[model samples]
Target: MAHSEIHLELLLGKQVLDSTGKPVGRLEEVRAEREGDEWIVRRYLIGVPALLERLSTWTIGLAILHSLGARNLHGGYEVPWEQMDLADPQKPRLRCTLEELKTLEQSNSQ
Candidate 1:
């Protein structure tokens, strides 16, 4: 599908998955790169830093800074898309479930 279509539909709250066929997190946005006519997804930013930045505490900026450092060291996030079991497959466009996302975080962190 075209990136525009993907952007309009595939992003903004789809569940993300890890390489091991396990839940990883939910996509905050679809990071992409332009090459000729295609917009290839580079990574799924996972929403944590974005969420952190909205908070009213010293933690927000720190988390954003920390995420910047971490991403630099780890390189770009390479999301595994085929395995995504979207929270609402029926709608094919729905916000990821927070409870499922928390479950994914705990399961993948180890």
Candidate 2:
């Protein structure tokens, strides 16, 4: 990590912008892996579904929302950490367009 690079903890809840400066969503969660002694962030999950996951007891609510197509209201995407530019920290931007990012998979928790 660069001296100016911010940690993933600081990145949570930060808004993410596409390469075109379009607002996508906030950084709801981060996926990381431990390599040797360092924890390297792999992806930044942005959307309401990601946010909902943080609330562990929302299973029934989430299922209802999904069944009613409310999940589409808060569609989530996962951007590879390497493709993100966090120089501003407050407004991390993706190197690619929003469509290029991977769509987050929904769980089978119905």
Candidate 3:
């Protein structure tokens, strides 16, 4: 299988698809940690809360997203980095089914 190198900026707004090719949501933020000298992505976060967090700096954009029905401020869906397939850099898709990705709540984030 051919793999593509994707940068964090390219992933920010890219669409995410489930294993079944269903549209799930967009890649909002990446949860990463520094190891030695490089930052490694641990999991991918998506959904309303993730979107809100990304747009927190832009109050206007945040307000618009909230108005668009993404009112959930305390939860998000998380897919482990290993579960994601980045072969198609333009469209990142998950290897596992939607149900497999864990739904993280407020407590989990902190």
Candidate 4:
């Protein structure tokens, strides 16, 4: 809709929800290709949730923070562009949500 320019700011802090519409991850950082003076996004560093599934939210939160090498806490996930679902123009974060992501995880284990 808005074009490439609108997509610039969207690279940072983009919330990446699972297919079930549950918060699973977010965009930790974006790696861009640099040519001469211009730096264009090449890929992204996803923030994966380090918290154990059954662990207390607070406990997992701290672990997630530690894994991130950050002083604070923020549990999420990291993935490549191909893994994310970008269907809706409005919800530019992710379409994978929790439930769908769970299915994906389960299948990957087998």
Give me the overall lDDT of model 4.
0.49
RMSD of each: 9.6, 3.7, 4.1, 8.9
TM-score of 1: 0.37
**Tens-digit lDDT track of model 4 for 1-110:** 33243364554556666556666655555546777876755544445432233233645666666788976433344444545555553455554444333322332357
**Which prediction has the highest TM-score against the true structure?**
2
Q: 1-110 in candidate 1: lDDT tens per residue?
A: 52333433545555554434455444554446889987766434455543332243325555667778854322113233433434444233223332333322342476
Between 2 and 3, whose TM-score is larger? 2
Candidate 1 local distance difference test against the native: 0.43
TM-score of 2: 0.78
> What TM value does model 3 have?
0.74
User: Against the true structure, candidate 2 has what lDDT?
Assistant: 0.77
lDDT against true structure, model 3: 0.78
As a whole number from 0 to 100, the lDDT of residue 81 in candidate 2 is 76
TM-score of structure candidate 4: 0.41
Clashing pairs in 1: none
Each candidate's lDDT (Cα)? 0.43, 0.77, 0.78, 0.49
- For model 1, how big is the CA root-mean-square deviation? 9.6
lDDT of 4 at 18: 59
Per-residue lDDT over 1-110 for candidate 2, one digit per residue giving the tens place of the 0 to 100 score: 45344676788888899999999898888878988977787887888777776565346667888798864464578788788888788888999998787666642222
